[model samples]
Target: MQPYFMPYLGYFQLARSCDQFVFLDDVNFIRRGFINRNRILLDGKPFAFSLPVIRASQNRPINRHSFAGAMELFLEQLRHTYRRAPFYGPVFRLVESLCLEPDMNVARKAAASVAAVFAYLGLPLNYSFASSHPAEGLGGECRILDICRRFDATAYHNAPGGRHLYDVAAFRAAGVCLRFVKGSFPAYGQPGAETFVPGLSIIDVLMNNAPERVSRMLDDYVLEHA
Candidate 1:
């Protein structure tokens, strides 16, 4: 549940369905993963927006992609790209404030920017980064179960992708119920689209509509079980 590149509405839908959400920042980043890039519709076409990360050593993990000297340029690029969008004025200022803050840690800056976006959209879920947790040798179901235990969560909810990776029966044995979130398309205000495109990055919604309207769009998303 990392704060990926302005994730789609389904991410927030799953977040609202859960009691507490964990940002899995300590995990390795897959090179082609959604960690630093996402797609959006622009000028009636799909385009990818991405952030550049410092290349890591061969032994270093993908999640270790760190911000290098190019951070200032990256922020400028985002401002330039988003400046003309509907809510870009306030959003750019907020992101710039965090990005340009003197001596701020890279991860903190990223997380703060994510929090700011969610705040503007009125999402109320609480968040914590995995790096802040105590060291433990847990992965797969055990890792999720541990979070549930710590928070006294009766159910552990995950995105649909976890079905192949997690054991539902094992979690039930440990007194935690496992639930997978099934995503549905939610309507949004987009320019010149005959049919709604689902799963475009959250920025698509933000740039096309106001904050209040975005909140209402999020409220309209329906969740189903697999």
Candidate 2:
């Protein structure tokens, strides 16, 4: 997975469910995707927050893109957005620590957010970037297969969104099993909403609920075999 900006609950679930995650930061950066942006709750409604990247392009890799501007406005937005939530103090601090890091590369920033959340929840899974170890393949499925083989993996787990793309026979032939994780955001109280909006960023989850509650909620998903 490419690093995402304070990704959704399902992203954390996918990480926690794995022993290790290889963030595919070396891959081509997808526009209009979750690489540098995520949905958060603002004014009790869904709002998208994006980390502006400098000269981001599909031709270039995610790790090559850097952040565009000072993070003050982004910080202010988060502070104003979740200030009144139940876990405001802790959540704000977490976001502050992660986003304000000196590293301005978008991949590092996004990965920092993921690491911060994982640490906050005491999740034990480890992670590395895809660029660190180049695997042999040129395209999507072949690249994924090469990655799995490079790590000598027995099984591969992907987000449910990749259901159509990952072929069962291909993985089986490589002596690896494939599975997809499906997560429905567990029902939780938002500060000012009558009905909860689902699939907001990890920031929303941290703001509205305690870490322990979110930790428990992380397990509220099913893994389907391919």
Candidate 3:
């Protein structure tokens, strides 16, 4: 899966369920996508925050994309939005550090943020970049198969959205079993919100809830045969 910019709870659930996770850094950057943007709860509503890419081309891969946004400005937004959150102090620092990182590439920055959050949550899943291993394949499914083969993986797990993209027999032919993960993101309290917003970033989750609660949320998912 592509590394996302402060992705939602489902992303963390996928990471937790996997033995090793791969971030697809070699793929083209999809503008206005989760790669550079995510929803964060703000004043009882879901609001989007984004990292602007510096003169990026759609043809360029995620590893080649550079950020053109101000870290202070972004941090200020987070500071005000999550001020009342229980874990704001720690999460704010982590988020600030990620935004101020020297690396400009979207993938590297996103990977750094994910790693930081995993550490904070004590998640033990191993993660790597797909670009680190040069791959040969065309379509999405073929490319995914190549990744599975590279890891000598006996099984592959993907988010439920890709259920149609893969076939059971095709993966079996490649010596891999395929499965889809669908998480039941139960509604949780957000400090300032009257009603809960389901798809806010993992940061939002951490800020408002205890680590134990968030860890339980990571386990609130079902894996289906693909």
Candidate 4:
């Protein structure tokens, strides 16, 4: 699916639940979508963190977009916002290393940063780029089906919002099972008595809890047949 901004725990759950996770970077419609922004809580208030993108032709690979000019500003914002977090030091160091590494491929850099974070937290999954695949004109359900076929996936899993867009009948006709992710809140080790904010970015959890605690939080989500 499309890359979302440091997406929620459920997104990682979906990634781990599948065999091969595809990043739909080639899709053009959701330019301003979560790929570059995510929500975080600071001083008990909700806020969004985003990255500035350099302009490029539509045909340019998402992995090629650059964040050169805004790197320092973005790092400063993250440091200022998350400095008080319980896991701030370690997370900040990781972010610092990734952001400063010499790389003009902005999309790849971001993807690598995300992968590194997930890896640090012990979530393992094979990630692939949709642009690398031989997709010509697939869209909507057809696109999902194409991925399923390419990966030999008998089941196609997606987030809850997918129910509104996925054609279940068509998938059934193609012999692929459709499934939706059901988020189980208040996963083990989540902060006690705190007002739960559902669907915030994973950074919220990382900042509020330790790595082991976050691992327990993974248990809170389940995949259900759609």
Candidate 5:
């Protein structure tokens, strides 16, 4: 999976479902995707928050992009937006540290957020970026296969959304098992909202629930063999 900007709960669930997780950062970035943006709660509704990327393009890899925005405003917005949240104090500090970090590389910054969340909850972050090992010129399932081979992995777990894109027989031929992880965001209380908004950034989750609660929610997923 590509590095996302503090993605939804299911993103963490997908990572938890696997023994090893790799971010496909070397692949071409997707515009209007979660690469540099995510939804958050504001005004009792889902508000999209995005990190402005310098010359972000679909042609370039995610790791090639750098953030180009006012870090202070972003942090302030988060502070003001979630001030009433129950766990906002600690959650804001975590998000503040991530946003205020000197490293502006979008992929690294986003991965740092994910890593920070796991670290906050005392969970092991057993993951790496695909660019760490070059499987240059390979894309799609071929690139995934190359990654699995590089890691000597026996199984490949993907989000349910891409279940149609893979060929189970091909993975079997390579001596690997392919499965799709199905996950749903277990609804939690969001201040001032009657209808729970699902799929908001993990920041929302952290702000609304305790770290221990969020850690338990990570296991809300099932794996289906392909």
Candidate 6:
């Protein structure tokens, strides 16, 4: 999957399910996609937050994009939104580091953000950037198969949405297992809201729940063959 900015719980669940995670950073950027933006809870409703990308275009791959200076705005927004949240201090520090890190390339920053969360929970991440392993001139499933072969990965796990894009029989024919993650995001309390707002960034989860509690939530998913 392409690296997403502080992605939703389902993203983490999918990552956790994999033995090796590969970011599709070489793919063309989707202008309105979650690659650089995601929602967060603010004022009892879901608020979208984004990193400004310099010269973002579908013609350019995600790794080629650089983030413009706007993380401070995002950090302030998080501070205001989750100030009263239960696990505010440490979570804020984590967010601060994620945003203020030296890396400004869109793909690397997003990848590091996910890595930071895994580190906070003491989970090991064995991940790579797709561009680094150049499957040049290949596209779609063919490119994915090449990646699997490079890693000697017997199984390729993806989010539930991937079921539509991949064929179980074809992958099986390639000596690979095709599986999809069905994420169960158990509802947790959020400040200033009685009705739960689901699918916000992982930052919201960390803010409202302790790292240990959030670690348990990572396992709240099921895997099935696609």
Worst 10 residues of 5 by lDDT: 69-78
Per-residue CA lDDT of model 1 for 119-224, tens digit only, reads: 8877786888776664478865677677778778777778887778777687778887778776665576566555677688776677767888777665654444
* Model 5 lDDT per residue over 126-194, tens place: 999999979757889998999899989999998889988998899999999998888867778888776
Give lDDT for model 4: 0.71
Residue 29 accuracy (lDDT) in model 3: 87
User: Can you list the residue pairs that collide in candidate 2?
Assistant: none
lDDT (0 to 1) per candidate: 0.66, 0.85, 0.85, 0.71, 0.87, 0.90
Runs of candidate 5 with Cα error greater than 4 angstroms are none
**lDDT score for residue 148 of model 6:** 95
TM-score of each: 0.81, 0.96, 0.95, 0.85, 0.96, 0.97
**Evaluated with lDDT, which candidate comes out highest?**
6
| Tens-place lDDT digits, model 6, residues 22-80 | 99999999998999999998887889887899999999999999999678888889888
Q: Name the top TM-score candidate.
A: 6
The lDDT, on a scale of 0 to 1, for candidate 1 is: 0.66
lDDT of 5: 0.87
TM-score of 2: 0.96
Ranked by lDDT, the better of candidates 3 and 6 is: 6
| Weakest 10 consecutive residues of candidate 4 by summed lDDT | 187-196
Judged by whole-model lDDT over C-alpha atoms, candidate 3 comes out at 0.85
The true-versus-predicted C-alpha distance at residue 187 of model 2, in Å, is: 1.4
Model 4: which residue pairs collide? 5-34
